[model samples]
Target: MFELKSVSKTFQLPNKDSLQVLQNLSLTVNKGEIFGLIGLSGAGKSTALRTFNLLEKPDSGHVYFQNKEIHGGQIDQLRLVRQKIGMIFQHFNLISNKTVEENVALPLKIAGWKPALIQARVLECLKLVHLENKNHSYPNQLSGGQKQRVAIARAIANHPDLLLADEPTSALDPITKIEILDCLTEINKKFGLTIIIATHEMNIVRRLCDRVAILDQGQIQEILPVARGEIHPQTKLGKMLLEIT
Candidate 1:
């Protein structure tokens, strides 16, 4: 459902030199698949993910959603396309001033959903993330896991076809991490959401993703399937991940 073709991104420094972040990065994500993008810090994993939402524009090449190119020139088209894609960050970007319900409903409200529809959708989304009873709570009152749940609820409230999760489990305790992973798994299964998760945590990828890609220095080093009986014979990242577990 999503494709990146020879996409590259660079940042200009004050000294006039450029830091190339993404170099001819290309990949495809299909419907009903959890594609894991794993790499060390500064490996361009986050930059590559940002290109999907045009949060970071590619310096060259194209990003296609369902075969349609997404770029800066097509703001209206990009907006409509982005409605089908949702994103969640490592830090739960919740508004401290808004109640949990309000936070989740904000996206729908911005999309111009009617009051009744937004209310119903917000409740439904909270229920999916198992946070239905906390609607009246504020972000300050929630735990790390609860905050992440609220973020997930907000991301999915629009019924997006694709969900981009950038280190969703990074800040949680081990037990909480498992719970959040389970919640994400449930969403993928129940809603057929295509998930592209950028994370350093291999355990989450092993448990959740159908296929995994290891990125290093703005390039994909390997792509492997996640199955107990399947062995990735050639990829260093896959072998390393398997040996660690």
Candidate 2:
């Protein structure tokens, strides 16, 4: 469903030097699969995730989503394709003043859905995240876990074909982290949503991802299949990250 080919990215530092974040990175994520990008800090995992939807334009290489080249498309055409992709960040990124339902409905409203349809979809999404009763509550009124759930609801509000979550559970407690991961897993299975998650948590990938790509020094070191069971990382960095987990 998604492909990245020889993707290379470099950012010009404030001092005028350039720092390469990705180098000849290539990956393929199948439809209806939960794919994980495993890496440590500054490993370019987040950068790689952003490239999936063209949020980060690689200095070189191509990104294809459903056979359509993302960077090659017209502005309007690219925008249309983006509507089918949803992203939720480490921070909840909720509107502080908007009610949970309003936040969840924002994407649909922007998509120009009828009021009745928006209301229906909002309620449906809230229920999926078990936030139905928190509809009238604002972000500040909800707990961290609740806020993340609302964010999840908002992200999937438009029934996106793909979901990209960056360090989704990194900020929550262990219990809350489990809850959010469970919700993501449920979302994947229930909607056949193809999910690509960028995280350093080995447990998270083990609990959720069908396959994982371990990255180090801006390059993909190995791609491990998680379906058979618990995987021991073969690469040095992968094993190092796993040791801390």
Candidate 3:
């Protein structure tokens, strides 16, 4: 569903030193698959993920979604492409002032959807995340888990074919993490959405992803399949990460 080809990215520090976040990084996410990008802090996993949404443009490579190159396009064209790809963040990224229904409906509204359709879709999305009852509530009124659920609902409200989640469970408790994962897994099965999760938590990958890629220093060290039976990690970092997971 998506591919990052020979991508490299760099950032300039305040002191004028250059930091290369990604160097010739390449990976693919298949249709209807839950793929994981696993890496520790500053390993460039998030930067790599951002390329999928064009939030971070590569210095020297191309990003392809469903075989279409995402490197250059008109603003309206790019906006349409982005509408087909949903993204959720670690911080939940919900509007503090908007009610749950309003938050979920904002994207559709921006797309010029009719009022009745937006309301219907918002309710459906809220129900998918099991938060329909909180439609009137604001972000401040909800618990952390509920807030993340709201974010998830808003992301999927447009019925996107692909979902990009950046450390969705990083800020939640272990038990709440399970709740969110269960919701994600259910959505993947119910909608057959191609899901890409960038996270440091191996357990999160093990629990939700069908295949996992271990990233280190801006490159994919290994990609491993997961199953119930015992399996070994091919790369050194993969093996080490497996041991800790």
Candidate 4:
């Protein structure tokens, strides 16, 4: 579904220093599969995820979506590409003033959907996230898990083909994290949505990912299959993650 070839990104520090977040990172995400990008805090997992939709333009290399290069394109074309890609973050990026339904409808409205269709789709997405009853609730009124569910609902409201989750469950408690993962799993099965989750949590990877790429210091250390029940990680960081859970 997506591919990154020799992608690299660097940030200019305040004191004239340069921090390379991604160094020649390359990977491919297959359609209908849940892929995991696993690493430590400064491993560039989030930066790499942002490159999927050009949220963080890479300093070098290429990003491809459905076999077409997506970098340096027309603004309209990039906007259209973004519509097909949904993203969720650790902090639920909801408009506190808007109700759950409105928050979910925001993207559809921006995409210029008709009122009737937006209403129907919003309800459908909320129901999928088990938040149908919480439509009238505000973000401040909901718990962390519920808020994340609302974010999920909003993300899928546009019927995106790929979902990018960056530390999605990091802020939640253990039980709530499981709930969110389960919700994502259900979405993947029901819609065959391709998911790329950037997280440091091994439990999340073990429970949800089909394959995982272990990254360290802005580089991809290894990519391993996770669906077969046993994962033999070779890198030091990967081994540590396996031992964590």
Candidate 5:
């Protein structure tokens, strides 16, 4: 449902130098699939994710969502298209002032839903993430896992077709990470949400994704299916991640 065609992005440095962050990075994510984008830092994994929603515009390529090219200056079209796409950050971007329910309900509010409908959707989303009891709590009162769950709830509040998760498990402990991954897996299966996650954690990919892409220096090096026995100690990215974990 998402496609990036011949996408390239570059930035001009202060020293009159040019840095290419993404180079002809073409990728297609199918519906109801959890696709993993894996790479070390500075490999353009985050950049590629940003391009999906036009957070970062490609210099010379096209980004298509459900066959419609997304370009800047189309505010109404962007908003309509973006409602189908949701993004979660490494840091839980919950509003410090808003309660969990309110935070989750924010999108529905923006979408102009009535109060009763918003309340119902927020409750369902919180329950889906196993955070039903914490709806009245604030972000500061919750654990890291709870906070991330809140973020996930908010992201899916609109029933988005695609979810872009950037390093969703990077800030959590092992057990919490597992819980969060389980929540994502459940969401994918239950809602058939197309998910594209950018992460350095092979375990996350192994546990959740159906297909994986290895990126380096702004280019995709390899894209493979998630195999049981093939995720061995010899794979470079897998090995590094295992060592770190």
Candidate 6:
């Protein structure tokens, strides 16, 4: 569904020194599968995930969605392509003032869907996340778990081909985290949505992903399949991630 080839990114520090975040990173994500990008903080997991939709433009690399490469010149094309990709964040980026229904309807409205269709689609998305009852409620009124579910509903409301989740469960309690994971699993199965989750937690990867990529210091340490049977991680970082989970 997506590919990043020799992608590299750097940030200039206040003192004028350069810090490289991703160095020649390359990876591919298959359709209809839950793929994970796992690493510690500052491992560039979020940056890598953002590159899929051009949210983080690489300094020197190619990002391909489906089969087409995204370039800076294709502004109009990029906007259209973004519609096929949905993203949710760790903090559950929601509008404080908007009701759940309106939040879910925002993308459809932007895409110029009629009011009736937006209303219907909003309801459908809310139902998918089991939040139909809270459509009229504001984000502040809901729990953390409910807020994340609403984010999920809003993200998938546009029927995006790919879903990018960045540190989705980091702010939740263990039970809430499990609930969110289960919700994600259900969404994946029901819609065949391709999901790419960036997280530091290996447990999330083990429970949800079909394959996992371990990233360290701006590069991919290794990629491994996650299964119930015993498996070995070849790299030091990969083994640590496996053992910690």
- Find the candidate with the highest TM-score and give its number: 4
Backbone clash count for every predicted candidate, in the order shown: 0, 0, 0, 0, 0, 0
Residues 1-245 of candidate 3 have per-residue lDDT tens digits of 79999999999999999999999998888999999899888889999989998889888998888988875556776788888888999999999999999999998987778997898899999999999999999999999999999999988988887999999998999999999999999999999999999998778888898998888889888888878523468887877777887
Give the lDDT ranking, best first.
4, 6, 2, 3, 5, 1
Comparing 2 with 6 on lDDT, the higher-scoring candidate is: 6
Candidate 3 displacement at residue 139 in angstroms: 0.3
Which scores better on lDDT, 3 or 6?
Answer: 6
What's every prediction's RMSD, in angstroms?
1.7, 1.2, 1.2, 1.0, 2.1, 1.2
TM-score-superior candidate, 4 or 5? 4
Tens-place lDDT digits, model 1, residues 1-245? 79999999888989999888899999999989998888888889999988988888999999988778888788888887787788899998899999999999988987778898898889889998888999999999999999999999998988888899998889899999999888998999998999999998678887889988888888988888888535463677656766674
Q: After superposition, how far is residue 209 of candidate 5 from its true place, in Å?
A: 0.7
- Model 4 CA lDDT for position 65: 89
Which prediction has the highest lDDT against the true structure?
A: 4
In model 2, what lDDT does residue 108 have? 90
lDDT of 2 by residue, 213-245 (tens): 998879999999897558877888878877887
Q: Report the alpha-carbon TM-score of model 4 versus the true structure.
A: 0.98
TM-score of 1: 0.94
**Candidate 5 C-alpha lDDT tens digits along 1-245:** 79999999998999999999999999999999999898889899999998999988889999999878988679998888887788899998889999999999998988778987899899999999988999899999999999999999999999898999999999999999999999999999999999999999777888998988888899987788887524544467646764674
TM-score of each: 0.94, 0.97, 0.97, 0.98, 0.93, 0.97
Residue 64 in model 1: shift from native, Å? 0.8
Please report, as a residue range, the 10-residue window in candidate 5 with the lowest summed lDDT: 229-238
